[model samples]
Target chain A: MRKGFRTDLRWSDVTPKEKWLNRRQLMAGAGALVLAAPALAQGTAAPGRYSTDEPPTSLEDISGYNNFYEFGYDKEDPARLAQGLTVDPWSVVIDGLVDRPGTYALDDLLSGVTLEERIYRFRCVEAWSMVVPWVGFELAALLGRVGVQPGARYVAFETLLRPEEMPGQRGGTIEWPYREGLRLDEAMHPLTLLATGIYNEPLPKQNGAPIRLVVPWKYGFKSIKSIVRISLVADRPQTTWNMLQPNEYGFYSNVNPQVDHPRWSQASERRVGGGLLAPRIDTLMFNGYADEVASLYAGMDLTRDF
Target chain B: MDGAASLNGALRRVPVWAVCGLGLVPLAVLVWRGLSGGLGIDPVKTLEHQLGLTALQLLLAGLVVTPLRRWTGVNLIRYRRAIGLLAFLYAALHLLVWLWLDLQLRWSEIGADLVKRPYVIVGMLGFACLVPLAMTSNGWSVRRLGAAAWQRLHRLAYAAVLLAALHYLLLVKVWSAEPLLYALAAAGLVALRWLWRRGRSGTVRA
Candidate 1:
């Protein structure tokens, strides 16, 4: 597996004259492939079109700063404590409202899928944002494989909750076995990705190792990590954050500049890696994925759902 | 000379400059860590939070000065100016971090935060109270306003200290012992001042 295989194609496939003329331009764009992590060399993946022109955040920042409260409450806790977690031999139980209801090994479940790079803007309910380059397949493809039943109107996710591994669960900050769900339509949205890795490497334990959901249009918390159970249900499942503070965290939890958090304004968000003195940009409707996801909630009151 | 020696010998020997320098150690360490990439993933947020915490701690220290003088006769009068100024400096830096770094002078967002966020409002109120106190901290302002009026004006420290403590309490998501510790310190200092004043009035009557 040659690293930057796509980049090699740019030069070898081009005419000598053309390559010479576009050398500088090609070198600058070479950055996209050059910084890719080792697993990205698998060459079965394609770059996503919706990716931002903005530079990808450093992996240290992306993996180091996280909000998996199952590990601990502090942002740095996940990186520090999650190292003890064992991820191999992982499997997920896909039950409820699915015709193919059974436990499946993660590798066997994703065996036929092609991983793709998706650069997305992740907005936290706490008013901080990050641009992440995640590698995964669409949730729709996985659901298709599972064979959803007609009664299923939602997709519920559950996180691993071993107190010995996830020490934070010993404390009552949030309920054990953190759960989240998306509307059936939302679960099937092409934009919704079930990420298995990031920066081309297999997902680190801190970043929800092996598997996680990445719902770009929703708040970061809505995208549950280290998922162990994925249930297709007829009703919306109780989410961890929403259950903890119903007024502050909603089930939909879409990124909206208009609706403010109870304690803070959501009009703008601090970009995590944007450095000191970096101007906070105004948050976008649906975190700038409005065109793709807005119609899903066309007539519904976003404020109420939010 | 003999009578003056008996008044407050310990206070005369107070290491005011040494204490102020010691107070600055945390800020220096934070800057050093920030420059060397030791402040974890988000250095700016870390810096902002640390500065705010330092400022709140300094405000608590400043509040304890008068009570210490009355109760223990270890007057920190000479170092009070430095302590107050240092608190103000850190508070000012905290505000600058939020304004210039966090919000990037996004006035509308700031206005919204002030209106919607009670913690921000309380924090700003605490900062506002410190402004007049910081302005009148020096000898010239003390002389110009007359010592009696100056002392009366600076009593706003009590309100500022309480507001700052409340601001910190409200800012935290969970009810940790850390914020409560600061709040208790502020409350104790305020209570000590009240007890000292009542005792002094009893002495006057006697």
Candidate 2:
């Protein structure tokens, strides 16, 4: 799977052009196919029309810093502890309110769709933000193929629960097999992706390997990781974070500066990769995807629904 | 028996300056890491957490001094003031990092956090309890306030440590072991002090 590279454009605009051109040339000659955790922004994934022009956070920071509590809670814990997680032989059980009610292999689910490179703004409920270049196809492509039933109103996702592999699950931090769901409309939105990889490489275990949901406009938690089961249900599913603290984390956890979490203000976010001293940027409504996603919540009060 | 006695005597000889200098090592390392880009991806959070954790650790160390003297006869009470001040130093730096670097002087956001965030309010109260203790951490202040009054004022440390632990517990979304352990330590030490007071009064009653 050759990820499209526009190195001559994105990084060239950010840093010196010659640097990226040279790096690309070297990577091309050196066999970039080995999947050795390729360096940051290497073979720059094409920025979607919605993706911000801001340079993607370094692949190291993106991969190393994560909140996949199935691995652990600390930002660094997932990277350190996500080892031994088995992603191969992976099949997703698509059941409940869907025509297709059987376990489908990861390859079978994604057999026909063309993978895209979507550089997206990822804002966590913790008020830390990052730009990621994800390699995947729209989730709606798979949902349409599965055939959502007439009664299906929400799309629920579940992460794998293997205590032997995921150490955090052994602890009582959260109920295992973390669950998240989105309204049917949000699930089928063009921007929603079921990411397979990042920075043009296969998904790292820490960053949700095999398959994961990516709702770019929403807080990062709404994008459940390392999914094993996806259900098209009639009612909204109880998401892990929201179930823990409903007032703090909403079901439709869209990134809104006005609705602050009880732990931290959402008005501004600290962008990673700036070391220690970079100033925080003002958070945008729907994480700057309001134009595309705002109408999904047309009449609903976000503050209340949030 | 001689070896244990000598080890205890050596520990007693450890000076206040050395204790403070050792306590400041984490701060120095933090600043150096911040400058050298070694503080990992989210350096501001790394800085804030390390500073806060170190402060809690130092407070725990200071609290353990009395138990050590009572149980083991280590008699290292002279270092208590330095340890308390060092904890206050890290707490101050932690708050500074949150205000200056993490928030970048977003006063409205800070105000919102104070009002809406339970953890933020608890942490502020913890730090607030430390303020008068920090100011009065001297021989002159003790003489001015009278020993009994000064001792009563310094009982704020008990409240401060509990608040700091609660603040940490609340900050984390889960009741994980790290914050829970800190909260337990804080509660255990305070309970130890209370038990000793009861023991002393029981002797008087007898």
Off by over 4 Å in 2: A1-48, B1-8, B202-206
Candidate models: Cα lDDT each: 0.82, 0.84
TM-score for the A chain of candidate 1:
0.87
Per-residue lDDT of candidate 1, residues B106-173 (tens digit):
89888888888999999999999999999999899999999779988987888888998999898766
- What's the TM-score of every candidate structure? 0.86, 0.89
DockQ for all models? 0.56, 0.74
Per DockQ, the best of the predicted structures is: 2
Docking class of 1: medium
